[model samples]
Target chain A: MGEAPLSWPDGNDRVPYWIYTDQGNYERELEKIFYGPVWNYVGLECEIPNPGDFKRTQIGDQSIIVVRDAEGGVNALVNRCAHRGVKICEQDKGSFSEIMCPYHQWTYDLKGNLQGVPFHRGVKGNGGMPADFSMADNGLDVLKVHVRNGGIFATMSDKTPPFETYMGNRILGYYDRELDGRSLSLLGHSRQRIGANWKLMLENIKDTHHASLLHVFFVTFGLFRVDNDSRVEMDDTGLHTALSSIRGKQELNDGTAQMRSFDSNLALNDPSLLDVVREFDGDQTVVMQTLWPNVILQQQSNTLATRQIVPKGPNSFELHWTFFGYEDDDEEMTARRLRQANLMGPAGLVSMDDGQILERTQEGILAHPNEQGVVELGGRGTDDADHMVTEVALRAFYKGYRNVMGL
Target chain B: MTITPELRSEIADLANAYALAIDDGELDRWPRFFASDCLYKIIAKENFDSGLPLGLLMCDSQGMLQDRMEAFSKLNVFGPRSWRHMLGAVYTTGSEKEISARTNFVIFETLAGKDTHILCAGEYRDIIIREHGALKFRERLCVYDTTMIPNSIVRPI
Candidate 1:
């Protein structure tokens, strides 16, 4: 068998299918994107609020442990045991005074320092270390941790810029608007394994054109119509984007007629599902923001949630959704958010179509590996667009992706 | 009051009917198995046990259930699949006015040319009441053991 020729198109407008299907590219992404100068979302600081509370998570394929120290500071450490490289913590979340390896009982403090070695000095001075093994030298690999508005982020690279500098003022403004000084309470969690490449999932989140076309529930129920006032904004680097739309009275226009889901007679028996309580004080009913690598902050109506995309392999990824509400929310406000939660999830009414669509998309591309996907709907560049029905966000993603992978 | 075999059989039949209705793609008939003001939710057992109120599908009223059925039938796009619901031993207590029953269930899925796979396994904690001369569910909580849902769950389990 001969080796297949690999080629990348000239610009961000064309994406080769092999990127999603090639094993070599996936491995390269793990190093260049995941392990490079990028701040990865680990978990929420509120998740480990109390002292000694910890949660196990991942950055790329490397397992990580996020815990609260005795001084109420958050720390992130590699979950591998320094001796034999065994996983130190196996449970998802717990409260522990110290992280003790169940295999050989190599104890580590919450800061991931090697505290004790069970058989050190050979238990009877027979077969342990030769008197020169320092416990301080065997501490677990720890990553730099940063927390902003209760959101925890970590990076393996010391060269990565500060969190604020990396996000820029525009993206930081959006984050502050959603979760600036407000305290968060975890309402629940839902995990879904999407049968597509991880990038495809992120692209779907950045896509605003598909909302009115693929998701009939969104347009039919008057949540977001094609004629609604909307825009797609991106940061100066084009690595981050937010597709925002405000609810307006539905009216028939050229754009509405072009959509396949523009049915005026469709009605919902339970209209309360579409009720917006105006919690954010902004008129935007939907705001889907995606950070470069894998973090998404969504404000759909009054429902607030953050999604972290973790790649399982080249062909699949796991989406971890953490739904939240304000700490000062009354019973009625919380109930409203909970009720609106039905609009987004693995089985969400307006968002469930994405899972199947992405799967089928990967399947379609796999059938023709030599072909390229045309992302020229908005234009041939990664600049910000003023209309929602544009593919500029996808172009922006490819731009950032190529910049990182050097493809 | 002591539970009678007649009431037990009636409740079992109601459970079976609900399962068959969903499995047979008669989703329009799903709302008929519940009362007007009812709660039907499919939640992870971990969340349910931890007092987390999140659910895969949370319908607070029969109207919401009807809306879900309509959306699944008319709006959602998914592959061709069929569900097979298997019910375990059902235990019922309480009087005829308001009966409580607990039973286990395993739902299997057969996609278009694929082998049948277990979709979800859970226990149903139901509150049944007599309404309009028939037993109906006032609240049905489907607590699943599987936390990570495969792809998407478009159908009721």
Candidate 2:
């Protein structure tokens, strides 16, 4: 498979199906993209607010442990043990004094410094090392950590640019708009394993064109309509994008339009389910910002969530959704967020179609591995679009993907 | 007040009727087993134990449940499937005004071309009450143990 010459089309708009089904390409992605010069979301800093609090997550398949030291600084370390390649911490999240390997009693400090060994010296003077072992040299591999608005990011490569620089001003401004200096309280978490390439999940999120078409709940309930005032903004590098739509009612008088079902008479039995409290200062009722590689920050109505995409293999990925709200939210506000949470997870009313659609995409593509997918909704380029009905974001994703994967 | 054998039988029938309504694709009738103002939530057992106010499906009123049924029937796109619910012994306490019943359940799902698999295993903490001379659930909290849901849980368990 490696001998086969793989190349993207001339305009980088046509994506080959083999990219989603090839094991060789998947391994190359792990090496070039996940372990390369790119920042990956480890966990939330608020998740480990107090000293000794820790959470175990993953960067691709590599296990990572993010903990708060005694000095209140965050640290992210590879979960692999130095002596033997075994995971030190197994639990998802906990508060611990030290990280100890379950296989052997090799212990490390909260900062991932090797602190102790079960039998460094000869226990009974029968057999021991030459006594020249240095604990500092045996510490767990630690990655450069960065925290912005309580979101923790880490990269294994030193060549990776600063987190803010990588995100650029436009993307950083978007994050600031939502999470600037505000503490996030973990509302809940839900995980869904999608049977498709990880890129497909990211594409599904950035495809703003499908919001009203595929998810009838969005149009039928007036959450979003095609005629609504909306825009898709992307950074200069086309690595990130922010798609938003202001709240608007569906237009029923558009009789000349081909799609008349957009004005369906179906209505929510309980209109309170579609109620909006206008938490944000603008008319933007829906905001979805996708950071290149694998992070999505979403504000759908009052429900706020951050999604971390972890690729399992060529044909599967796991999405970790951490639902959150402001730390200063009152009871009614929190309830509104919880009620609106029904709009976006594995069981979300408007978003559940994504899972099935992604699966069917993978299944369909596997049938014709040599075929190319044509993505020309708005045009064959990666630029910001003035309208929401466009596939420019998908093209932008493929552009960044080609750059990272060095295709 | 003591729960007599006749009352227990009626409660069991109510539970069976509710399960059958969902399993037999009679989603329109599923909301009829609940009171007008009911709380129906499907939460992971971890969240329920930790007192986290989150649920996969959190419906505070019968209206929301009816909306969900309508959405599943009209709008959602999912493969052909069937659900079978098995309930264990129901332990009841409290009076007729508000009876607290705890029962174990295991739901098996059979997809279009796949074998039947254990979709969920959980316990239901129900608050049953007498409304309109019938036993109906005022609060039905389905707390399941599986945290990582498979594909998508489109239907109610």
lDDT (Cα, 0-100) at A347 in candidate 1: 88
Relative to the true interface, what fraction of contacts does candidate 1 keep? 0.69
lDDT of 2 by residue, A1-407 (tens): 45555777787678888899888899999988888888898777767889999998999889999999999999999999998999888888889999888888889999999998877787888665558988889999999999888899999998998988899998888788778778988787777788899988888878886766777788666576556678888876676889888876655644214344364677777777777888777789888888877789989888988999999999999888888888999988888888999887888897788988898899889766678998898888888887777888888888888887877
Off by over 4 Å in 1: none
- Give a tens-digit lDDT track for model 1, residues A332-354: 88888888888888888877889
- By lDDT, who's the top model here? 1
Q: After best superposition, candidate 1 residue A294: deviation in angstroms?
A: 1.2
Scored against the true structure, residue B149 in model 2 reaches a CA lDDT of 73
Best model number under DockQ: 1
Model 1 chain A poorest ten-residue lDDT run? A1-10
Give the share of true interchain contacts found in each model: 0.69, 0.63
